[model samples]
Target: MNIKKTVEKIPGGMMLAPLFLGAVLHTFWPGTGKYFGSFTNGMITGVVPILAVWLFCMGASIKISATGTVLKKSGTLVATKIATAWVCAFVFAQLLPEGGMVKTGFFAGLSVLAIVAAMD
Candidate 1:
């Protein structure tokens, strides 16, 4: 199946895919990630390697002259996203009893990840 094409059909699939995979793994086999956390088989070996490579590729792809402009624009958008998420998190934190799932409603139960992922 064309997973990329399928995800692309849904809005914000880039972010949603990882989230969905996480949720499925957490729900069905909670210990799977930890079990895979080994030198040969890894899960939380973490995103550092991927991030480092991505950063290097991005740096190589961009023109030095455009770096400032790129940073300025992306920084503004990131700042705005952070501010908006902060407000939402603050509101939820004040309203909710604790980081538990709400059986009664959409956000009766919430987690720090849910709060932050929205911003991400």
Candidate 2:
């Protein structure tokens, strides 16, 4: 099967494919990272730092010659996204317990961090 072609046919599949795979892995084998205990564990737990560098590169790619109007619009959209995510996180925090959600129920492993990441 042509996995690249299959993913290309689905809207946003390039982004969603890895997410689906990760979710499956986390659900079925949450200890897979710890089991491997080295590079695999680092890859699993080091997502934030890697993502920060990727995002920095993305931001740095914006051309300095872009018009003020374009920058303003993009800035407004980004601000709105951040604000909405913050509000959602705040609401989730209020609803969840002090340490966050439960670890072994229907909502197991769901946390404010995940919610914010999904929202933003």
Q: Per-residue alpha-carbon lDDT of model 2 for 1-120, expressed as tens digits?
A: 999799989898766775677678878998987999877766565677546655777668777777577779989999999999999999999988778775787998888998999998
lDDT of 2 at 110: 89
Off by over 4 Å in 2: 1-66
- The lDDT of each candidate is 0.69, 0.80
Q: What overall lDDT, based on C-alpha atoms, would model 2 receive against the true structure?
A: 0.80
TM-score of each: 0.46, 0.45
Stretches of model 1 off by over 4 angstroms after superposition: 1-51, 98-109
Q: In candidate 1, list every pair of residues with a backbone clash.
A: 100-109, 101-109, 102-108, 102-109
